[model samples]
Each structure stands twice: as C-alpha cells, then as structure tokens.
Target: METPSSDASAPSPWADAERIVLGRDARGGAVAVALDRGGEHGRRPLSSTELPVWVSAREAEGAATGRGIRWVWSSTAAWYSALLGAGVRVSRAHDLRLCHAVLRDAVPSASALREATAWDGAPAEAGPSAGALFELDDLSGNGAAGSRRPGRDGVAETVAELLRQDAAVAQAAHPGRMRLLLAAESAGALAAAEMRAAGVPWDAEHHDRILRDALGDRRAGGAPARMTRLAAEVREALGDPALSIDSPPRLLRALQRAGIRVESTSKWELGEIEHPAIAPLLEYKRLARLLTANGWAWLDEWVRDGRFRPVYIPGGVVTGRWASSGGGALQLPRQLRGALRADPGWRIVAADVAQLEPRVLAAMARDERMAEAARGRDLYEGIVAAGAVRTRAEAKIAVLGAMYGATTGDSGRLVPRLRRVFPDAMALVDAAARTGEEGGVVTTWLGRTSPPPDDAWRAAQARASRSGASPADETRALRIGRDRGRFTRNYVVQGTAAEWALAWLADVRLRLTRLAPVDSGEGAPRSGPAFARRAHLAFFLHDEVIVHAPAEHADAAAEALREAAEAAGRLLFGAFPIDFPLDLRISDSAAKD
Candidate 1:
C-alpha cells in the first residue's frame, strides 16, 4: 500500500515542508492545519465526533498514494492515543515534546527552542484514557498557560515551536544523524501509543492457570496454599514458628539466629550459606515476588478485553532506551511468557537480535576484527572460533567485560586478552570510560549525549583535590569515578542499541501497515481498527519485538521481521559489515524464549 517514496530508511524531503499541525483553532476547538513552503493554510476545525473520521480519511489517503503527510503534534500520547482508540493510524509524526528533550541536551546551539516555555517539561503522558474522546474543552484556552502542554495551545504557539524545531535541526552539528534520531524517536512514540492501544494478545485463562501451578490455589485474605506450605517449611528450618517470612529484616534476623549468617535474604547470598532454610526461603521469596508483582490483582487490573496494554515512555532512559511508566511490561518473567497468547485465527512471530550490544559496538567502532568475530548467528561462538578465547563462555565473559567495564574477577583478567584481539572496540569503550572518569560527557552513535556527573559527584572530586583532603575523601572520589566510568562505558553501546531497536520497530510498523486487512470475522476488536487480522507489532522490548498477525500471513510477518532487522542495521551503520542475527520463531504462544 506504500509507494516507493515511503522508504523508512531515510528522512523524507517533502515531509519537512508538508507539515500537518494538529492543535486548537481560534475559539478552542481541535483543528488540522496545512503548512507548505513556510506558510500555514486556514484551520479546518474537527468536532469531537468528526475528529477520528477526518484523521482516518487523511491518513488512509496518504497511505494510498506515494506521498505521505508527516503529522506535527504536541505529543504522541496526547493525540495518537485518541486516534488509535478510534482505530485511526498516522504514518509519521514530529513529536515536539520528544524532539525538544533530545535537542535540549544533544544540540547546545538550539537555545531558542530550549528556552521556550512548556517545551522542556515532562512529556505529555499522564493524560486521559485512550478510549475517551478528546473534546474542545481539553484543547481550548487552557493550554500552555494553564496545563503547560504546547499541544493544547492555539495555532500560533504550536506552529512557532514546530518552526523552531526545524531551525534546531538545521543548526545541529550532525543534522543528518540528528534528523534520523529525532525521526526514529518520534516513530517510537507512535509505536508505543499503538502498542498500548493494540496491547499484547493476552489469555486471562492461561495466566490464571500458570498462577495456580506456580503459586497454588488462591486463598481469601491469605497467602496461596503452596506459599503457606513453603513459609512453614522455612520457619521450621529456622526454628521460629512465629517468623514473619514476608519481612526481609525479620527473615534475615531469624536466619542469623539459626546460624545461617548472611547480609540479606537474597537468593544469591542465601545460596552460599549451607543452611536447610536457604532453599525453602529462596523458594518462598520467589513465590512472594510473583504474587506481589503479577498476581491476581495485577491480572484484574492490566488485562482487559483479551489484551494487556502498557504505557511506554520513549527516551525515558538517559541512554534513549524506552521505559514503562506503568504496567511493568519490560520485566515480565519467563514463566508468564505463555500468557502472552495470540488471538484465535492468528499467530505470534517473535524475534530478538542475538548479542545486539556487541554487534552495535563493532559497527560503531568500525572494528573489522570484532565484526568478523560477530558475523555469525552466535557472537560468543564466533569469538571463540576466532581464537579470542578457548570457550564460548570465556568469550562471552571478555566481551561483556569490555562493554560493561568489569575490572575485578575473571572479566578483569580476560578483558586485557580481548583488548589485544579487538583493539578498536576496546579502545572505543576505554575512551568513553576515561572521559566519564574525568567528568566529561560521551555521545552515542546517533548523537545521544550522556548525562554528566551530578553535583554530589563533583563535590567529592573537589574534596579529593583540596589541600587538606583526607584519605577517606580521596578513596570516595576514586570509587565514584570508577562507578561513573563503568556507566558511560555501557551507555554508548546500550543507547545505540536502543536507537537500532527503534529503527527496527518503526520499519516493522511501516511494513505491517502495507499488509492488507483481513476479513471482518477474523479481526481482533480489542486491538482496534488500524490493526485488524493483518500483521501488527503487538509488543516491544529493548532488543525484541512480537508481531500479531493472521495465520495466513505468518510467513510474510516473519519475513518483515527479518527484513526490518537488516534495514535497521543499514540505517544505523551504512555498508558496515556487521550482522544482527535473530533467534526468530513462529509460535502460537510466546512461551519459547
């Protein structure tokens, strides 16, 4: 359904000129204005009832022809959620809030927009429901002055910010890279809103069954049967019948009294102590975590209409990785993957890049040796075969040490050996670490600048440098410096990996849009109208994505997932011979890790 001009690898030329701003009209009603060659056309007001219909018409029009319109909106969550609720989908958007955050830190020259009002605040999430209609009252005179959301402002303020953003990109040090980052970030916002609207195809029954098996039968106003049994076993082993297993401090004290001396009740620490209570206590803690994090209460709250919607905040992490404001979507346990079921007549295509961070680092450093070690399906195995290490396990340790700045155990000892083999890759991370240790900042491959040291950190360094500073102050300073160094060492790799994932997600979203919608009976109504039986990205983590598609188009969906991976690699590092192989699967359930 997309024309040749709709390639997602590069930024659009005409989209910059053909701006469609969605904001309030004069008297306080929502409107879509057209801007061309730097001038705005008259506003076309959209009523609450007519808003989704008009947007769907325009969006469908763009998808039909080769030419597409890039929607300039205040925030993706503020507007796109309502659009998706009505089953309308837009191709691309210029999320002013998301873009402003990027430019504020990355581009110092763009001070005008950075100093602008309401553009630097927290993103436009925490709004009303996606299913609720956005009326005139929400977009009227209560804009930046009252709500501090530029999207709520009248036509003039909104357009002014958009133009300022245009200027920001023009003055960027690497405008091309900045443009790609902004586009990828904005596309991520679109995908987040869409994913929340569509949600993961969830099976409430499967979730309950899993809960029953792991946690035992639910009890009214009490712990599960299996949990109670485990708690009893733990108490008996500790020789304290009145032991409060839920309280960590009390449990730790009980363990100490029973001769199992440990710092905490953590599984890792408890496992080292050869005490009978350790095993049952560990099992109890595991079950308790599950009950508290994703129990019956969670299922009742998150899962709705056969879907689990999660609120994603794009660029929430300083490293440009996505974070969840609610729903704990990124931390779902492996045991519950089976609960992420596809709807009837549909299949789930799941895929994740293998050794994503290492591959990204190889490309960024332009290290041919490292790239050769990462050319195959398993980067660790390839590293072993290249004689970097004797075994795959050792190779993994060295590579992880290089990226994460581990300098203490086997990682510390093996990293030097890796340094000799992959000098370029090691040098890149080493430079970042040194910069961070000196209170300097580092930028990712896509121009995402790392945050500098905080006031407390600088004060510690200052104390250490003073004439009368004691050994304590100097020791504290050295410790904190190493900590910051480790952070920056991984920040570059993780941030670029996030950018690559965003590109992959955006391309997959665009590709899925091109697939024809299936018949009416096969539609997943809970997923909204925009994503019917056709393939649609239902869930996304930092390095993985799960597409929900009709059974008939499963193969096509799988191909789209693979092609999007290749496109993302090229988009980030053109002609860089680095592979991002996926452990892909076509399954009825997400149980396969």
Candidate 2:
C-alpha cells in the first residue's frame, strides 16, 4: 500500500531501474513501479496526459545510459498501440496477458498461478481508446464473485503476477528454455501490433485490375461478367438450365439427378468424378471464392489509403502461431500477391525460409545424418541424395508423413525408407506420438507443453481398459488416440518453428529501428506516422516476412532480415549444423518471378 513520496527533491530508488511495471491506478491513470533483480523498489503515478511524455523521457534516458528497460504491461495491444500513436516506441515489453496464458497451460511449476484464472482472457483488440489497463474478463467463470476484478488493473496485482511468473520460470524443468519461450512470445506481441500499425502496402487500382482480369467487369449488385458466364456454363453442363449453382444442396441434387452419383458437392469430389460439368464447376468455385473473399466489397472495406490493415492475434493458435481476426492476412492467396505493391519511393523485401519445420526437427533431434543431408541445399533434395527416396516428390511426402504420423498411401510406403536413413529423427517423432497415444503431454523444443487430454478423452481411455469392454469402445478409443497422436507429433515441430519465427521477427524489428529514417520529403507518409519514414515490417506469415523500406535503404533492410534469421538460428540451436536458407527478393511487389 506504500506509494512513492510526492516530494520533488526526494532521491528516487528507481533512478536506474532495470525492469518497470506499468498499470492503471484506481482513478484510471498511469502508475509506474520500478524493480531491480532483487524486487520492487519504488512506485510513482502519472496522469493520462503525462503518460506519453513520461515514457518518451524514460526511453531517451535508458538509451543514453546504456540501460535496457523492459516494460511490463497488461497487454501490448492495449498499451503499445497508444504509445505508437503518440510517437513513442519501446524496445521490449512483458505482455502479462500473453505470458499468463502460456504459463498457466505450459509451466507445471506455476500451478498456483493457474488456479487464479483472472488473467485468462482473449487478447484485447486495438481500438480508438486504451480501455482498461488490465481488463480481466474471467471468461472461465473462476474469478471472485464471477464479476470483473478492477483491482487486478493496479500495480500491486501486476507486480504479484510478475513475481509468480519469474518463480515459475526459475523452478521449471528447463529454466533457460522456459525463459527464452516467454521472451520470444512477448516479443511476438510487439511485432503483431507494429505490423498492424504499419499496414501492408496495397494498390487499389492494381487490385481492381487483377480482379477484373480474373472475374471480368464488376457489376453493381450481382456476380461479375465472367462468373456469370461460368455459372451459365455449369448449369448447361448439368442439363439444368435454371438450377442454382451457388446453393450446395441444389447443386448436389442436380448432380445426382444428372447421373453424376456424387456423395458430396465438394470440389475435390467433383474433380474425381468423370463428368462433363466437372471442369466448369471447378472454375466457377474458384472464381466465386475470389469474388466473395476479396472482391470490390473487400477492397472498399479492408484497404484504405493504399494499406491493408489486418488485426493480427499473437499466440492465437495453441501451437503459438499467429491468427488474424479480420482481413485474412495469413490466407492471402498467391493470385493476389501482386496487389501487395510498395509506395513510389519504397521497395518490398520479401523473404521466406525453406522447409522450416524439418530443419527445426533436424536441429532438435541432433541427427547428424539428417543435418548432413540438409547441408547447403533443399532438404527434400538432400534426402534424395542420401538415397532415402527415389525422387524429390517422394522424399517430400515421406518427410511430411514422418512428422504428421501418416500411416497409409504413398506417404506411408515411402516413410520407412526415411526411417531407415534417419533413425534418430524418426525416433524423436515416434516417441512424441507414443506419449500422446498414452494420454501423456509433450513439450516443444522451447518448453511449450501440449495441453492435457480432456475429460471425454480420459473417459474413453478408461472405458477401453475396463473389464468386459465392448469392441466398439476399444475401436473408438484407439481411433481417437491415433488422431491425438498425430496432433502431438506435429505440435512439437510446428510450435518450435513458431518460436524461431518470433525470434527472427523481434531481432529484425530491432535492427530496422537502428537504420536511419528517411527525410520527410522522401518518406512514404501514407504508411502512417510511426513507420512513414523508416524501414518497418509490413507483413508476417509463420516463416516469411516482408519489410517495406525506402528505396535508398532497401539493401540495408534486406541484410538485416538475413542477419536476424541467422541470429535466431544461433539463439535456438547453438552449434547445430542445420541451416535455414531464405528465398529472398527485393522488388516493387510481393509477386515472385
């Protein structure tokens, strides 16, 4: 309950603090609590109007004195967006909302904190207002009185949570890896916000042109000219002139009546059938997707002032990959890549890692043979050179099968060859699969533990073990168990790859900030105030990134992206001979040649 003395001349214990905790006070104002490696030392309060200036001064002072200040806040989306709006950027932050989710589920040593589910809530979306500093929604219905807890928004609760997290990390089975996971996860939150603020460069005219070229001219309230023609062709091919091609039920019934005898109306099923309507129906479906997903309506809604601003959710997926709530950032079709155009005086540096998951698997298992195979070339090609499979196509299928627990088809037939050639890597995934089948949890390379089986799964397993159990019960249990086994087999590799991507993004963001900003006259002002004059990240998928840089600084930005990737590799797997080469390009648009 003690507060910092208001006396102006009082010597402050937080003069050179290493970590600072920030939260809102009872009156909805900013509160700063300073801490060292020992513990909290002092606390101060600032008004809403003074918060920006205070942060700016602290950042300047920290930079001048060679002190790296890591800001601890409730949520990056809530706090950092406002700071960026006011032209203040922090190098590092500890997002309690994101970290709470990770620690509650993954860290066994943090059982005590897990019981307090007040911090378990979906991430706050970016909006005009900062809203509550700590909006503990208690979505799980476990908080006190089943009501909101405003006290958690204060500095005291923030400090308590931080202490609990630190203790959890220290007591974890692998403290070093747990710490790295938390840091990378937190950094990912920052990058997500920055990407949203600096939206991807889009050319509305070019987008419209692409749409027209594919779908023909746009109409006012109906399908485009080409889509209409395709729909007509599909109807005629089915011999039902008035049948609605858009409705699945109607289409399926029509196909059945037309002697197609298909069970479903899916494109894949339709493709397999030998019928006259197949090709036209497939083309109609493709054009319909483009029209509905990214048509003129989409252009009017999502893109604005030459930027597509999507809402990115960091740590959204259970495997630690990002998910977008709107704008379909992750699912940007290759057909639309050309619309990702840079500004007049800027260039886009697009880079994506090749075969990220398998390389991670090689480094994690320390399979020297697999690493040797992956030396300086495509992993699938390396597998072929090592005589594991006859062709690159077969090698790809076999490696994917091994990681995903595929047990049938050409993938299944080819997997044994890889198993013989790379026994260590095969053993790693095989063990993970076995653990999952036995209702056990597994952890990724950086300590992200998989969720425990639910009550239903446990009940099924128990039923299968009981005396006089029916064959149906045993079969069901075995099927579900294998399904979960496949999931856990892939989880470790995918989650670790996500961690690597986060590390790469964080390092690249830091390096880009160090590059000199373009002058006002030469800057791409349409990129918003925070990133208009500097090299900034524009988009990020799981293993790929696009940096929008001024034309003069394009080379520097490209080098930074490469260096960050190498740094991430070293940070994750020290001295491991695994390499992650990027297919990098610096061009005016994101389209590949």
Candidate 3:
C-alpha cells in the first residue's frame, strides 16, 4: 500500500473537497480519495493507526471552516464504528452498501449498479477479520446477477460504484426524491451505530424492582413467585392440579376438558371465552411472557454500566424500518420503560409522532380534507368531528382498515365512510392494493419500491386462471392475492413513514451535536467518551425518540426534537400543508405515566 506523503509542507488534498471516499487499498489498508465538485483531487493510503487521527482532523477542520464533507464509504456499519470508537464523528456520509440495495431494488432496469450484483449482499458488520470486507455471499438470485468482476474489494471498485449510483439517481424517474431517500437511509445507518455506542440509560435497580413487584420474587430454576401462584390458580380453576400451563398443546387439551371451547389459547380468543380458568390463565400467560422476554436473564445480558446497549439494524425490515438484533430493543415493553432513567443532573426528552402512518398517507395523497382533520389535534377525533364516523374508535378502525386492506369485521364495515370522506387518501392505498393484487410492485412516496410478488404467488395465480381450475384453487389464490395486497397497501404508507422518521432522526442528531456539552462533573460517563458530556440521542423506536440531555438543555433539546419533526415533514412533502405533531415529554424517566 502507498504510504502517506512525507512532505510536511504539502497542501492537504481534503482542504476543499466536498466529498471523500474511504475504502481499503489492495493491501487491506485504509485509503481515502478527496473529491471536489469537478472530480477526484488526490488519493492517499494511511496506516490503520493514522486513519482515525486524519479523519478527526478533517472533520474538525470542516466544522471550523464551514466546509461540509460528506464521507462516502462501502459500508457505514463496517467503517463508522471504528471512527466512533476513536471519538471521531462526521456530519454526513454516503453508505454505498445501503444505497446499492435501495437502487438495485428501486431502479433495477436503469441502474448500472444493479448489473454489478456483487454489492447485493447483506451489509457488512463491524469486527470482521482483515481482508474479508467485500467477501459476501452472492445473493444475486433475488434478481440481479453478480459479474465475475475482479478487484471488487479495492478502493477503485468503491469509487466506481459511487459514480454508478450517482448516474442511476440522476436518471431515475424522480431523481430528487430518490436522492433524498438515499441520503436519509444513509443517515439512519450512521444514527444506528451512534445509538448503539451511546446506549439507553437503564436503571437496573428500578428494572429489577418493577419486575419483582409485578411477577413476585425471582426463583432459582423456575418461573417467578407470582407466575407460579397464577399457574396454580389456573389449575385450581380447571380442577386439574397437576396441569402444565406452559405447553400450548397440553394447555389446549386441558382447557377443552374443562369445557372452555376455544380453537387457540391466544389471549384474544381466551378473553372472549367466559370461564373460571380464563382469568387466571390469562394472568399466567402475561406473567410468563414478562419472565421469558425481559426477566432476570435479559437484565443480566443486556444491561451494563447503567445502560442498555442493543444492536440496531437499519433497513432490516422490508419496509425500510429498523430492526433490533439482540435485547428486544424494538419490542421494549411499556412496563419496563421506568427503567430508562437518565443520569444525575440530566433529563430525557421523549417524543413520538402522532398517527404517523395515517398522517403520511394524507401528505402523500395531498388530501386537503384529511390534512384539515389532522391539524393541531387527534386525527381520529377530527374524523369524527367531520362526521366521517360516529365515534373516534370507528374513525381509527376505518383509517387502519383502509390502509391495511381490511375487508371484514367493524374495521371493514366502517371503511366505506372513510372512503367517502377522504377519497384521495383512500384512493392512493386502494390503487396500491389493486396493483399488488395483480402481482405488480408499488413504490413509496420517496421511490422505495415494494418487493415484487414471489414465484409462489405467481404460480398460484396461474393455477387459478387455468381453463379447468377448481373452486378451491380459485379461493386459495384470492386469499393469497389479498394478503399480498394488504402488505403492499400498508407498505406505501409505512415505508414513507419510515423515511419521515429517518429524516427526523438525522435532523435531531445534527441539532443535538450543535449543543454544547455539559460540565465534566455532570457528564454521563457511561454514555462513552464521545457522547458523555453532550446532548445526544439515546433511544429511537419507529416514531419515538429519547434524548439524554443535561437538565439545563432540556428545553432546547425538546425544541430541537419538535423542530426536527417539522423539518422532516417539509423535507418529505415540501410545504404540503401537512403537520407531524409530536406527543412530547421531558422527564427524568422514559415511563409514559
């Protein structure tokens, strides 16, 4: 690998570059190329030991001189972690791995990158062995085919991919929107890494206390005390003292023997059945879930140094929403939120968007009536006020049914009224559903396309359309088609909502970095060296975000959160007269109450 130049008086190549691409040289060593508006200005290889210092210096210089630098790298997850570990943070980045996935699926026919399907593999995680950066399995069978292209792992390959992506975006049907989507998606990758590094403030004592209070005392090798008691109550009510409630099949048999006729033991079905054993059985199941999901074992494994550090996977879901690998981060139970306690002299600003999906639909469709209904208050209540439904409950059910393709029960029955009131909003989802039912793909507002129907679905449709197809075959095909329709119908709204959430997170992260750090004595040491003294994002759910900030900056953090929500709306919809109101709270704990 080429070494850093020895001339001390040489002008820095990165001094005026607007973008920099970082990758490994042929020798598996770090290399960076600076790019101005015209093209590449210079390229240099750096020792692994020198990489962090060089990046930090460039980042600091960029910040001081107002010369924003957007880092372009093969994978944010693989590269950003090392920089963050060394206390270096960048304002912007372009993750080629993530953008490749987006464009490959979104603009498959037009994207030159789609032809180079070696990039179609899963995202690279941190801590891989040296020289294994681009050694990913060929997942090109999904559509794109990998070429026998040499030098796929080098800096030159990365630069070439970046150029292809730029051309793809420029030639896309909605270039501006696609560009914004890629930027937001890349930002989410950075935020996910940063959030993992700076974990949520967890009060282990508080979490344990809550668990004990709810499930009774812990036991050595069995369920908690309250769970055991509830299990016993269920058996007593069923007149089967030795019954095993943990086994679904055995419990189903036991319930049937006790005259509780239910097909499944799910809580919803059990709640509908009025029996002496039902209440205790339900209680036992709830307690059992608590013990299994977030009990002592979970606490021991997930929490450390008063923080819960969960691994967040950006774009993990098909809808472009984030997913958690461990610690059930996305599935955090409301009961344990009290454990999300901030450090001393600090506060947590918790905010979540109100009816995010429905609001996104309204904005995407530009439905003026729906937007009016959503102005400054609860949307369901607004729908009720507009006479679309008799109650807020019906309005909510109808809106969800309209978006989710519900054709049965109360939700289905009330959807027609919503269609009449919000025709444009309903029409958008209806069209998406129709396209899905016909086995066609649908695109979100920002150009993230829904995955096409699989071969199984197409084969089923073909069987149903045969000359002598059976009625059963037809029925089965219709069911499968409608199921996919529901998925696609929701995909447009949910995917766009994910985009809005990313925009919100990216903006909030930038604004938080602008705030000055608190005194050293008041810093949250457990938040790691980079974020210990500053207001930084601590937790993010689909629509909710929690910021750990010093008490003195609580108001400012809350304001930034609200402003980011507004900015996200404008960024996605551009003055469409739609609002993304937030249910915000500033408190010492993240508990809803």
Candidate 1 Cα outliers beyond 4 Å, as residue runs: 1-17, 126-151
Model 1: per-residue lDDT, tens digit, 166-280?
Answer: 8888888788999999999999999999898788999999999999999999898999999999999999998999999998889889988888768987788888878788788
Residue 337 of model 1 has an lDDT of 94
What lDDT tens digits, residue by residue, belong to model 2 across residues 1-593? 23544343344555578888887665556788888887767678876556666777777667877987889987888878877777677888898889888887777667766765667877566531445645445422244422456543656666777877887787777889988888899998888888888889999999999999999998998889998888888889889999999999999999999999889989878889888788888998998998889888899999999999999999888899999999999998898999999999899999999999999999989999999988899999999999999999999999999999999999889999989999999989999998998999998888888988878789889999999999999998998899889989999999999999999999999999999988856587777778989999999999999999999999999999999999999999999988888888999999976
Query: What's model 3's lDDT at 551?
Result: 91
Alpha-carbon shift of residue 313 in model 1 (angstroms): 1.3
How many clashes (backbone N, Cα, C below 3 Å) per candidate? 0, 0, 0
State the lDDT of candidate 3 residue by residue for 1-593, as single tens digits.
Answer: 22377442245867788888887665577778888879878788777677777888778777767988899988888888877877778889998888998898888765467788777776666731242454323312122334434432557667777888988898777999999999999999989889888899999999999999999988898888888888989999988988999999999999999998999999999999998899988988988888889999999999999999998889999899999889999999999999999999899999999999999999999999999999999999999998999998898889989988989999878999999999999999999999999999998889998999998899999999999999999998998999999999999999999999999999999999989988757589888888988999999999999999999899999999999999999999998988999998999999987
**Model 3, which residues run further than 4 Å from truth?**
1-10, 127-131, 135-153
Instruction: Please report, in order, the local distance difference test score of every candidate based on alpha carbons.
Output: 0.83, 0.85, 0.87
Better of 1 and 3 by TM-score: 3
Lowest summed lDDT window (length 10), candidate 2: 138-147
Stronger candidate by lDDT (1 vs 3): 3
C-alpha lDDT of candidate 2 relative to the true structure: 0.85
Each prediction's Cα RMSD? 5.2, 3.2, 3.2
The clash number for model 2 is 0
